[model samples]
Target: MSRLVACLVLLALPALAAEPAPRRPVHTYSIVARDPVTGELGVAVQSHWFSVGATVPWAEAGVGAVATQSFVDPSYGRLGLEMMRAGRSAQESLAGLLAADGAPGVRQVAMVDAQGRVAAHTGDRCIVAAGHVVGEGFSVQANMMERDTVWPAMAKAFREAKGDLAERMLAALEAAEAQGGDIRGRQSAALVVVSAKSTGRPWVDRRFDLRVDDHAQPLVELRRLLTLQRAYNAMNEGDLALERKDTDGALAAYGAAEKLVPDNAEMVFWHAISLVGVGRVDEAVPLLQRTYKADPRWRELVLRLPRAGLLPDDPKLLARLTGAKAVKK
Candidate 1:
C-alpha cells in the first residue's frame, strides 16, 4: 500500500478492534427514516452541541440512513452506511457495529435501510431519559433528554404528520422539542433527505440537506431554511422549463416560487423576466414594476440583461419595462 493508505488503514484499526475511540457526548435526539411513498431515505437531528449536524447524521441514496449520537462514535454513521451499501440489512449493520464497539453502552443510534427495514439502539449507560423507538420504515432515538416522552412524541408526530419525508422528519424534531428537548437546551440541528434511487449524481440525489449550526432556536431556523430551499427548487424548475420552451410550465413554477416567498425581489424579478421572454410584455410589466418598487437595483439589472441575451435588445421593450429611455451607443 502507499504510505498515505497505510497510515489511513492503521488509524482505522482501533475501530475494527473494538478499542475505545475518542468520542463526544453528543447527547441528542434524532430520527432515521425511509419515505414509503417517495422511497427517499433521511436522517434528522438536534443537539445542544455546536454543529451537531456535522457529526450525527449519515445517509446514502439507495442504501440507508444512520444517526449516531450520545457519546457518539461518528464511525457508526459512516461504517453503518458502508455495510448497508454492501447489502447488509439495517438491523444486521447496527448489530455488527454495536458488537464491535468497546463502549456500546454510551451510544444511541438508529438506522433505516432503503428497503424500509429499521433498527435502533440506546445504550444502558446513556444519560437519564434516554430511549428509542423503532417503527415501520423508521426509528427515533434520544439521550440526555429532559423527558423520556421525547422519542415517543417524535414517533407519534412522524406517523400522523403530512407532507414529504423532509416535512415529516421536521415534525418529529419539533415534537421532540415540544416534549422538552435536550436537557441543556438546543444549539444545532440538521436534516438530510435523499432520493429513493440514485441518479448516479450525488448532487441531484440529495433532495434536501439543511443545517442550523448554532442557534437559539435551531429547529425554527431549520424550517425557514427549508422553505427557502423549496422556493429555490421551484425557481430551478422554472429555469428548466424555460430551457425546454415550455411556457406554461415555466409560468407555473415561477408562480409557485413567487407565492412561497412573495417578498423576495430575486424571484419576482426572474418571474418578470420570464414573462417577457415568452412575449407576454403586458403581464411582465406589473411584476417588473413590483420588483422595481421593492428595489431600484432590479431596474438597473434590466438594463444589463439585453447585452447578456437574457432579454431582447429592443429599445422599445426596454423603455416600457424600465420606464426610462435607453441611451444610444
Candidate 2:
C-alpha cells in the first residue's frame, strides 16, 4: 500500500506544479516632463497599441504627470496623481504604487511632480530593451523597443532641444523614433500638457490634449496634429478677442493663425467672415475674394450665410462676398 501511495503522489506532482504566468507587454515608449521656467507639466507617448495614450498617459493641473505602460494598470495613473496631489513626491508616489501592485515586475511607469521632481520604474520582467532615463526635469521610459538605445536617445534629444516644454517633449519622441521605436511598429500616439496653476476649471487648465487613435505613421501624424492645434488655438484667441470688442487684437490674432497655416482654406474663410462681422467689409472683401478664388465652396457657404443668419441680410454685402456685386435694396 505504501508503494502504491508513493506512485500516486509521483503521478500528481506534474499536475500540481504552477504554470508560467502571462505577459501583457504594452511595448511602448513615452516621456513625462515639466518645464523648469513655466512649471507646466506634459506627457507624450507612441505605441503599437490602440489608443495607447488613453491608457498610458495622465496629468493634472498643479500636480504631476504620469505614464504607465507594460501590462498597464491604469490604476497607477489615477493613484499616482492622487498621491501627488496629496503632497507626495514623485518617488513616494511610485513607491506607493509598487507596494500596492501585485505584479510590479511587468510594469513600467514614470512620474514628474509639479516641482520638476522625476521618478521612474521599469519592471524586471519587462520586455527586452526596456528601461528609463531620468533627466533634469523629465523622465523617458521605454519597453519592448527595437533597441536599448531608445530611452537614451530621447534623453539626449530632450536635453539638447531648444524650445518650450511641448517642443522639447516632442523632440524627445522624434529622437526615440529615429533610434527605432517599438519592436512591433507604431499605431497610436497622444500628448497632454497642463498649466502649473490650477484654474479650478479642467478645460481652462488643460493647455493641450491631442491624440491619434489609429495611424500608420503615428509620430509624424502626432507632430502635424500639434501644429494644427497651435494654429487653432490662435483662432480661438482671436474669437475671444472679438468677443471683447478688441477688433485690432482680433485681426492680429486671426492673421497670426492664418500665417501659421497659410494654406488652410477654412481658417482664411473664417477670418474673412470675422472681418465682415466687425464692420470691416472693405478689408474682408479682398480676403473673401481670395478664399473664393481658391475654394468655390467658400462662395457657396457665403451665399447660404444670409439664410442661416451667419452673415448680414444685406444683398450688397452678399454680392461682394460672392463677387457678383448685385446690389438689390
Candidate 3:
C-alpha cells in the first residue's frame, strides 16, 4: 500500500509542477465616449500586450464607440456595436450584454452612445486596483494597474484636456501612464474616432485613427502621428474648396495646412496648384518650377494638362504656367 501511494504521489507532483491552473487575465480596460459638440463617437485603448487594437476600440460612424478588454473575449466588441446599431442606448446595451456573459467576472468594458449616454464595467476577477470612472461624456477604466489612482488620473485628464476627441483620448492615456499604468508595462495603444456625416466611405470617415503596435513610448508616437494626420486633413479640405472655386476658402485652408507641415512636398505642390487656379500664376511659377525640378515627371504631366482639360489650351497660358519652352508651329 505504501509503495502504491508513493507512485501516485510522484505522478501528481509532476503534473502540478509542469502546468499550473490558468489564472484569470489581468491586463484589460476600455473607454467608450461621445463628443458632445460634434456627436462623434470615439474609442481608445492601451495594453501591456501586443495588438490591443484587435480586441479593443470599436466604433460605428453614427452610432457609438465601445472598448472591450481584460481577459478579452472579442465577442463584446462585435456585439456591442451590433446592439448600438439596433438602437439600444449605451447603458441598456452594456448591462444586458454583461449580465448574459458566462465569464462576466473576467471581462472589462466601456461604452457610450451618440447622445452621450455612457456605461462601464470592470469584472470582479480582474486584478486588484481595477475600477472605472464615468464622466459626463466619457469613461476611463483600467485594470492590473501599478497603483490605485490610475483610473482617476485618466478621468481628470479627459475632463481637463483641451482639444478634439482624439486629443482628449490621448490625454487620458497619458494621465494613466503618469499614475502608474499597466503594472507589467506598456506595448500597444490605439485611437479611433468616427464622424457624424456617415459618408459610407470608411477611409474618409475617420476623424482620427492611429495605432502603435509595439513601442517603448507608444502614446508619444501616437500624438505626433495625430498632428501629422490633422495637417493632411486640412490640406484635403483646402483642395476640396479649390475645386468649388472658393479661392478665399482654399487659400485659408491651404495656408493653415502648410503652416502645420511647411516642408511637405505634397503641401508645397498643392499650394502651387491652388495659386495657379486662382490666377496667381506669376506667384505660382517659382513653386511649380521647384516642384517640377525635384521630379521631372511633374513637368510631363503639366504639359498634358491642357489635353486633360485641367488647363486652358492657349500656348501663352501653358508656357507661363510650365516655364517651359513653347512648342513651335
Cα lDDT listed for each candidate = 0.88, 0.85, 0.77
Q: 54 in model 2: Cα distance from truth in Å?
A: 1.3
Candidates sorted by TM-score, best first = 1, 2, 3
lDDT of 2 at 252: 79
Query: Tens digit of lDDT per residue, candidate 1, span 7-36?
Result: 443445576667454579999999999999
Candidate 3 lDDT, 1-329, residue by residue in tens: 23433343343444434543233253854566788898888988888888777667888888788888777766566666766676777776777666556677887888887788888888898876799999998998989999989999888888888988888888888888888789898888889999865788988888888888889987887887888888889888987786787876877777677778776666666777677767888877777777776786776666776675555677877777677678431
TM-score for all predictions? 0.92, 0.86, 0.82
Residue 205 C-alpha lDDT in model 2: 88
Better of 1 and 2 by TM-score: 1
Q: Say what the RMSD of model 1 is.
A: 4.3
- Which candidate number maximizes TM-score? 1
Off by over 4 Å in 1: 1-21, 327-329
The digit string of per-residue lDDT tens for model 2 on 1-329 reads 23433443344333323322234456799999999999999999999988987789999999999999998877778767877887778887787667656788999999999999999999999998899999888999999999999999999999999988888999999999999999899999999999998999999789889999999999899888888888888888887876676767777778888888888886787788778877888888888878878978888788776675556889877887778859454
- In model 1, residue pairs whose N, Cα or C atoms come closer than 3 Å (at least 3 residues apart or on different chains), thus clashing, are none
**TM-score head-to-head 2 vs 3, winner:** 2
Once model 3 is optimally superposed onto the true structure by TM-score, how far is the C-alpha of residue 273 displaced, in angstroms?
0.7
